[model samples]
Target: MKAIHLKTLTTIAAAMVLSASFPSYAAEDMSKMDMKTPMPDASAVTEGMVKKIDKDAGKITIKHGPISNLQMPGMTMVFHAADPAMLDQVKEGDKVKFHVEKMNGALTITNIEATTK
Candidate 1:
């Protein structure tokens, strides 16, 4: 009985020491904890031409180059706008740089800018 009690205490102390060596993110502010996907860098932006825009549907169709962040090949596809006003920033046939990510099970354009080329 004495040996069993000593071993249990030693195991508890070891666990406590191991746990202290790691930082705890759970104690941080929940609001600051962004569980969403990380924002892509400027280099991750894909060049594309706007093929269509439907403000009412809040969607944009783009014929874009390979998206490195997504590991997606160059293709034309419809994407949801993170903000409906994003659709107003470009018209059909405009050349643009954009960032896209999967959000809520849908492909969404998080950032977009019109380009002269």
Candidate 2:
């Protein structure tokens, strides 16, 4: 009976040692942290005005004043859209609130619908 008690204590001590060593080697997963915070998903967007539209080049030159993600050191300039078809409903001097996305190095307008009051 004394030998059995010694073995049980040894097993308990081994288990405690293993439990203490496990968390030290573990790392926290950062994938859950949202670094690319998304903006409000709404069609009610009413901002920016169109500066230029070129049908021949299939692109539009938007003088985007300031965008949330477009935060940079220099002033705003013209941006190119992959699909000029997005400009079908938009016209020069028309106020719009469009959202752009970068896909494979090209900045494209993913959403450019009209905005209501």
Candidate 3:
């Protein structure tokens, strides 16, 4: 009985020491954390030309260079706008920089801006 109690106490002490060595995050306030996804920077934006804009369909067609983010080759394709208002910012034949992501089973343009070039 004495040996069993001694072994149990030793096991409990070892467990307590092991747990104390690791920092606990439970005490930290999660509400103060920035949980939103960070926006892609300018370097992540792909250069493209507006091939078409269909406001009624809430889509835009772009001829874009290789999109490294999507592992896509340079090609012309239609994309749904994450926000329909994004279509209002560009017209056909305009050079633009944009970012795309797969959302709701569709390729959606998350960001876009017309370029002087």
Candidate 4:
């Protein structure tokens, strides 16, 4: 009877140890953690004035015209560009029509050409 009791205890201990050693795959769904949302590739076009420029930081501030994101009913306000290179052909008080696109995690101007207006 003593041997039987020891065997039962040993079996229970082994079972517990084995269960604890491995991850609990049966309890929860692992697929949800790996899932990610697909974001759209959207670009913005604006006609604005260059308010500030920082060449080192790759950023430019623009007093944009009629920014829809701010619910702005056509007002002049400052915005930061994802790339400082956008200011290469532009400077303060220069009138330009810039095309900004979302890349990586920031809004950058992919195409910036000079305008006569």
Which candidate gets the maximum lDDT versus the true structure? 1
TM-scores for all predictions:
0.65, 0.50, 0.65, 0.46
Which regions of candidate 1 are displaced past 4 Å?
A: 1-40
Root-mean-square deviation of every model: 7.6, 14.8, 9.5, 15.0
Candidate 3 TM-score to native: 0.65
Give lDDT for model 2. Answer: 0.62
- Per residue, candidate 2 scores C-alpha lDDT tens digits across 7-109 of 8999999999999987643235555555433434643222566778887776766666455554432234565665667778788877777776667876656
lDDT of each: 0.89, 0.62, 0.87, 0.60
TM-score of 2: 0.50
Screening candidate 1 with a backbone cut-off below 3 angstroms (N, C-alpha, C), the clashing residue pairs are none
Candidate 2, RMSD to the unseen true structure: 14.8
How well does candidate 2 score on lDDT at residue 59?
71
Question: Which is the better candidate, 2 or 3, if ranked by TM-score?
Answer: 3
Q: After superposition, how far is residue 34 of candidate 2 from its true place, in Å?
A: 28
Give residue 51's lDDT in candidate 3 (0 to 100): 90
Which ten contiguous residues of candidate 3 have the minimum total lDDT?
A: 30-39
